[model samples]
Target: MKKIIFFHLLNDYSGSPKVLLQVIEAVAKKGFEAELYVGGGAEGGFLSSAPCVQKRYFYKRFENKYLTLLSYSLSQLILFIKLLRYRHASAIFYVNTLLPFGAALAGRVLGIQVIYHIHETSIRPRPLKLFLRWMVERCSSENIFVSHFLAKAESFTNIESRVIYNSIPQNMVSSGANHVYPYASGNKFNVLMICSLKAYKGVNEFVRIADLLSGQQDIEFNLVLGASDSEVDDFFSSVTLPDNLTIISRCKDVIPYYQRASVLLSLSKPEEWVETFGLTILEALSFGVPCIVPPVGGPVELVSEDKEGYLIDSNRVEDIAAKLAFLHKNPEVCFRLSEAARVKSLSFSVDNFESDVIEVFNGV
Candidate 1:
């Protein structure tokens, strides 16, 4: 491709946008002309600090769920119109996530190659999910899944698909290499979990585990969520947080947390939400921090059972608590897992991801 145009619905501090940012950086580094067409109101957000490139806004972000739906629908309509401007240009339309179907439709009509980077399978409203899948089969030329589990879960019969696992940003990988495990310093056992502000992500379960282990003064729980301060406060307004557990909202820099983390946890409820790929788990593992991932989905691929980490049911609060307590008491086992976790993370490097992206683009 001579040039590429990217589309994403939200530009918030989330996994999808961060992954997109890495793709853009990789493409741009190869001297390819790149431009972004994304939603507005991304000031101080993750994508707001994207590399030097022309950017256009189609819609604004909304807080309410219903308004978010209306806004995204309107954004798609606006995006369809905006994409029509590049009808004569030889640019690939790279749509991120399933929300930007209008870009795919416009690309189909414009006769431009469209590649969808599928990340999640937990889209709501069955009809919408089916409609997006149908759009992918009919409109897109190729689909790039973030994990093998996601590729299998959202298989398209006609469209060519490839599984490209997301990699940690280079900065994080370098930071992780030099990070010192806090447990070695005889610090409090810090169990860290960083994720979006979603109930299905098992925020309540993390807190419940913290409550269960509250009697252990040496263990501390840190929950870092991608949300505004007010949103975080509102989410826990009715719930009581244990003194040992600290809730950190809207964390921009998680390097410090990783440096101090004794063990990282991915407590996403499998039935409610099967994580396509847990970026936080990868990040934690890069820091030589053993992680506890859900028993299913892409996270299982990143973490090995009883090796890098355990694949446990997040819903099993007592079991998860027991595992955490075991890790705390058995420092030798935890250190072994921590070392293995770091080695496991090396395979998912950004260089490999960039090479894969180039391969996919060149093949097309």
Candidate 2:
């Protein structure tokens, strides 16, 4: 059966875009036809290479939040008409909750079926939450989540949502350059966190750790942070640590950073509902780098107390610093942990992601 997928935009300079691209390619390779509706992309959104995966730019640009939402609704209407011409396509796959509302509304008008996807750990807008729950209660048939943690974290009351971890293509895994170290250094260790430098991301925790280690006679702490270029300056302003701690902003490629780093550090606070699935931790492990994460949220799900890694029970600065010291102090333990990391990363393969999506569509 032909399947059409919809997305808000494809300007994927980030992790989510990459994951969506993988899913699109998976759908196309499985021989099910796919289509994408996107808004303004980043210098010609180069998200995929699937010929069967069609694309249509619904808007010239996405600016002014209110106007952008209006454009999305209009685009959905146009897409709905196009799909109405082909009633044989069994399912419509929507990428976000907001789009799903539009898809469900369109489905009702066109007598079509929809399968929605959930990716975030949580979202705000209290009324929208209520509206989404009400809509899902009436319109949704099947729903899929990126991680079980995300499904549990969402406030929307719903039936069982299948958990499908994001997978990287085995080819993308086995082939992509086996991490070449990028920085020139002496004995000082490289610490990396591949995430937007938002407050909740606990970037400050890295600062706190850096501050603790800054005066240590032996080591220089380098942090490579990949922030959005839009907020490059804002992210830069968030830094308050010493001169020894270096922060690189708006990097185009993070793979080299991950490769060069001795250990991946994720020290977000409270380990609350927001830290649902640790995609960054999985990516780090995929590169054979051991990760240190707080034990509360998604990181615990991804990184266990293996020989190479441990979860910090406290969000306190001292606890995080102690963990870092342990890893650096015992290089042998670090290498052993990395070996285990490579094994664990295998479970998040994109090939498996494709297979899972196909099975869901085929009702397996």
Candidate 3:
């Protein structure tokens, strides 16, 4: 078996980096030898302190535009040379961003088989797309997508792409319903929305949903937010919530919050910017937390009407509020969605993810 390497070099603490890391960790635990190629030195970046991942050369906290580009090229060149020197003919490369034209050419020169892992709805044009297509279409390797929608978008590429959803472990999923008092009151159902307050994430509708569910005797909205940018963080810092809402920014383990919530609210607008595979929705569903998602995007692949979660017709606040009101008024529906959600989520366990990814790498 050829040794495998996973490649990514970004200072952003984003979901795709975490997904790549999860794949690396899963492969490592299975006793497979794999190297996680990530730059380090940035204090708050995704690659910093990633467990079971070996830090390569010059990962030291980079910013400044030119330096960032320089850092990217240098890191890949180093990784490419390292892979060639390792006596491995095949390598699995995971990329969240497009590379400079030079780096792509260097990888081909190194004779390393690269697997491009794309986890976003956004695409870069011009020389970037041309370079990426050349790398994938001409390289004769695998392309991994987090959702079918993403795979289909890249269908024009002659490269073979596969959709494998991100998975969470079954044991890590919360099994018991525990501790829900501090956030909610007397039979009020808990509605959870875990996302950064970005335009793409539709943060205002999250606020709107809370506003609609406001003053309800049987419902409270709990927000789990990560700071995407300083402006957004500042916006969240200044906001005041209604009496029916409780906003929590601290959650290292979201499964507990997932278990406590009666429903997960996804209010992201336009299928493209909002979601890729609905990873948060999967997390919620895994713990028997029913979800309410705006009818759009990759979430369509996961959410069905009254099944895993409710697919409300609109992103409008009234419709979302109306749905929440229904969930609150009829607790039976919540329980039913909860049960169904759990069953659906179990199919996406991390074990399944590991097996699928390994099989793809192994040509199984």
Which candidate number would show the highest lDDT if scored against the true structure?
Answer: 1
Note the residue pairs that clash in candidate 2: 167-349, 167-350, 168-349, 168-350, 308-337
Instruction: For residues 1-364, write the lDDT of model 3, one tens digit per residue.
Output: 5556556655444566667767776667667666655555544544454555565555443436567656756765675565556444554444443442223344566665556677755543345566666666665456788888877766545667778888764455545223222223345578888875565676777887787767776777787776544545566676776787766653455766765677788877764364667778887776677777867667888888878777774367788788778777777777777777777876777777988887876682
Model 1 over residues 1-364: C-alpha lDDT tens digits?
A: 5688888877777899999999988887888888887776545667777674756656765667788778878888888988888889998999999889999999999999999999989888778899998999888999999999999999998788999999989999999898866663447999999999999999999999999999999999999999989999888999988999998988899988898889899988888889999999999999999999998999989998999989998989999999999999999998899889989999899999999998877886
lDDT by residue (22-133, candidate 2, tens digit) is 7677767767667766555334333544345555555543446677667755765676565555455565655553443655666656666666676654443556566766
Superposition error at 227 for model 2 (Å): 3.7
Model 3 earns a TM-score of 0.80
TM-score between candidate 1 and the true structure: 0.97
- Number of the top-ranking candidate, with TM-score as the measure: 1
lDDT of candidate 2 at residue 322, scale 0 to 100: 74
Could you estimate the TM-score for every candidate? Answer: 0.97, 0.80, 0.80
Ranking by lDDT: 1, 3, 2
Runs of candidate 1 exceeding 4 Å displacement: 60-64, 184-186
Q: What overall lDDT goes with each candidate model? A: 0.88, 0.64, 0.65
Q: Tell me the spans in candidate 2 whose CA falls farther than 4 Å from its real position.
A: 41-91, 96-100, 153-160, 175-186, 217-226, 238-241, 270-273, 306-308
